[model samples]
Target: MNVRPAEPMFVSVPPRPQRLLHSEAYIKYIEGLQADSKYISNWDKQLRANTENTPVPDQSRLPTHWLGNGAGNHGSVVNALWMLRDFMMKDALGINKTI
Candidate 1:
């Protein structure tokens, strides 16, 4: 038997339970738990930043502007996430690993 990493595999589809709240976000949260601390924090930061500010994609600012600051949970979520940096660095460097 051989397993080829690049070989295409087919999967059967299963319908999700109708009662689940946020199927995608829940999956993302779980996947983050499986990753290292660096990946979890940095990935969240990257995703939040990459989110589009305007409906017209790149037109909100320049096509290259960093839109992370105002992606909007009424402007609160982004602020709170960045605020974590005030107490400690995201890398958790020089601190206990269990932190």
Candidate 2:
């Protein structure tokens, strides 16, 4: 499903403005993102609107859970989301190949 981003949500591969190797820039960026920031609220509103008639989704999983760290706690989730954003940007940044 296509979910519009709440923000630009760009995570540049290798980060355009270089910072410490520790990558505090990545950490700070995702720290501000939330499940609601990824159009999850839109999905939720649609679901609520359908509840009165349509059968809401069953046995379904939404990708937005990762935004809220549904799989684990803070650090791991942060890394996962950060990496995902970086991967999505790879092609546009001419980083299609990985070693």
Candidate 3:
């Protein structure tokens, strides 16, 4: 599913004005990551929208007792989301191969 970006996303890390690694491939990889990071904000928004609308069976809905316990807390969800998002962005940028 191709989702359009909702808003401009600034990369937390800026591009390296000068290549410190001195390898063409490495420099190219960094450039790709910079480009991917620019899309991160939109990507996250799409991911959130997708996840939010996911259908959960009423019978399987967690009770209040289980809401924030057993690895299902907000922190865990946020961490997992970030990890997945980072992985997807890196894959899109082809950093997976370089790594």
Tell me the whole-model lDDT of each prediction, alpha carbons only: 0.50, 0.51, 0.53
lDDT of 1: 0.50
Top candidate, metric lDDT: 3
Model 3: per-residue Cα lDDT over 2-92, one tens digit each: 9987875765787768855566656765565755365524455545654456543453333334334433543554444444555776677
TM-score of each: 0.23, 0.22, 0.23
Global Cα lDDT for candidate 3: 0.53
RMSD (CA, Å), candidate 2 to true, equals 25.5
Which residue window of length 10 is worst by lDDT in model 3? 59-68
Backbone clashes under 3 angstroms, per model: 0, 0, 0
Compose the digit string of candidate 1's lDDT tens values, residues 1-99: 988688558777898878856776678778767544655445445544423541333443332233355435545444443444433454555477766
Candidate 1 backbone collisions, by pair: none
Q: Which stretches of candidate 1 lie over 4 Å from their true place?
A: 1-18, 29-80, 85-88, 96-99
For candidate 2, give the lDDT.
Answer: 0.51
Ranked by lDDT from best down, the candidates are: 3, 2, 1
User: How many clashing pairs does model 2 include?
Assistant: 0
Top candidate on TM-score is 3
Candidates 2 and 3 compared: the better one by lDDT is 3
